[model samples]
Structure formats: structure tokens, C-alpha cells
Target: MIGVNDILSPGMIVAHPDRPDWGDGQVQSSIGSRITVNFREAGKQVIDGDRVALQLLSAD
Candidate 1:
């Protein structure tokens, strides 16, 4: 399981299992291992917090 810290910067895309195939948005910020993302789905602000929905396109 990779975290925000593993990410380089925002605007990066990551696919979450529970979430949409494109829900993954740019990384807003990296708090320790927590990654805050600007979830934008059809111009809608989605809440992206813990439970980052494993099985996502993480940065390896």
C-alpha cells in the first residue's frame, strides 16, 4: 500500500477500486503517509480521505 509520501506531486492520477476509474485526481498535499487529492468527478467535489480504496493505481 503506497501513501501520498510515495507520490511526487499533485495532478497525478490514481485509480481506486471503489472509486471511479477516473475519480483519481491530482494530489493536493501529502500529510505523512496520507494523501489529500482534489477529487473531481463531472465537475463535482468528492470526499477523498482514508480508505483510499485499495487496489488503486499507486505510484510504484
Candidate 2:
């Protein structure tokens, strides 16, 4: 299980498990239980860190 302690930060890339429409997103901000991601397709979206398990994506 991913938690806030997993060390998420700005510029990190991630994918939403249930929101493919949003496409890949770059982490913009992480504060407490809220995470802001700027996606390719869906623009900026604020996700609940406690409720969503975001998949970390590699730049490679």
C-alpha cells in the first residue's frame, strides 16, 4: 500500500488506476492527504492520497 510517506513530490510522473482518461500526470504538489497532478489529457487534477493508489511511472 502506498502512503504519504512513500515520498511523492513535484515532477514525479504517475498514472491513475481508474482514470485513464486523465492519462499520465506529473506530480505538481503533495500536501498531507491531497496530491495535485498535471495530466496530459485531463489537465490538473487534485487527488486524494489516502484513497487513491497512484502508479508511479518512469521517465525511461
Candidate 3:
């Protein structure tokens, strides 16, 4: 599970842990356990932080 410190904020860059096809993503929002990311290839998606730990690429 991702802690509050580990939680990413808006405009942060990230990548999917399991889906390379999803490509690079930009974090839209991180609220509680819900994270919204807009991917370069796969578009925007809402991820459950409790279930999948997203890899942070860079800060906003």
C-alpha cells in the first residue's frame, strides 16, 4: 500500500508497473487511494493505489 508521502500529486510523470503498452503517464490527481493518470498511449485511467503500486517517474 502507498503511504501519504508516497502519494503523487498533479502533473507528476509516471509509468504503469505491469503495462508497458500504457506508456508514460502524467498524474492528474491523487486522492486517498484513488489515482488518476493520463497515459500517452492508453489515455486517462483511475487506479487503486491499494491494489497496484504505481512507479513514479518524476515530480511535477
Candidate 4:
């Protein structure tokens, strides 16, 4: 099944569902279930899309 992360592309804005302190993040790259994001407050983070469902903030 296609998950939300599966549709996420680079440049899309997102937020960590569990780490609100990480603040908003921009999708740098997404490969399979691995997603690399640069957070506003936490810097770069490689999130496991299979484990975390990042909330979509903006597609543009």
C-alpha cells in the first residue's frame, strides 16, 4: 500500500508527529522508507517513514 510518505517529494514541508520541538521540516530526499529532512529547530534528521508518519504542512 502507498503511504503518505510514499507520495512525499523533495521540497515538501512537514512536521514530526512525535517531535513537535523539532519544528517544521523540509523534505530533502525520500528513498523507499527512508526520509531525510532538515528541521527548523533540530537541523537535519533522517526519519524512518515506516515508523513515523510526518504531518504534511505544505506541498509547495
Give the whole-model CA lDDT for all candidates, comma-separated: 0.51, 0.84, 0.85, 0.95
The residue-by-residue lDDT of candidate 4 on 1-60, one tens digit each, is 777799999999999999999999999999989999999999999999999999999999
Model 3 lDDT per residue over 1-60, tens place: 535326689988998889989999999988887899999999999988888788888886
Count backbone clashes in candidate 4.
0
| Order of models, best TM-score first | 4, 3, 2, 1
- How do all the candidates rank in terms of lDDT, highest first? 4, 3, 2, 1
Give a tens-digit lDDT track for model 2, residues 4-38. Answer: 32678888899999999889999998888789999
Worst 10 residues of 1 by lDDT: 42-51
Leading candidate by lDDT: 4
In the predicted model 3, the residue pairs found to clash are none
- For candidate 4, report its TM-score: 0.95
- Using lDDT as the yardstick, the better of models 1 and 3 is 3
Per-prediction tally of clashes = 2, 0, 0, 0
Q: Which stretches of candidate 2 lie over 4 Å from their true place?
A: 1-5
- TM-scores, in order shown? 0.46, 0.84, 0.87, 0.95
Number of backbone clashes in candidate 2: 0
Compared with the true structure, the alpha-carbon lDDT of candidate 1 equals: 0.51
The superposed Cα distance between candidate 2 and the true structure at residue 27, in angstroms, equals 0.2
Tell me which of candidates 2 and 4 scores higher on lDDT: 4
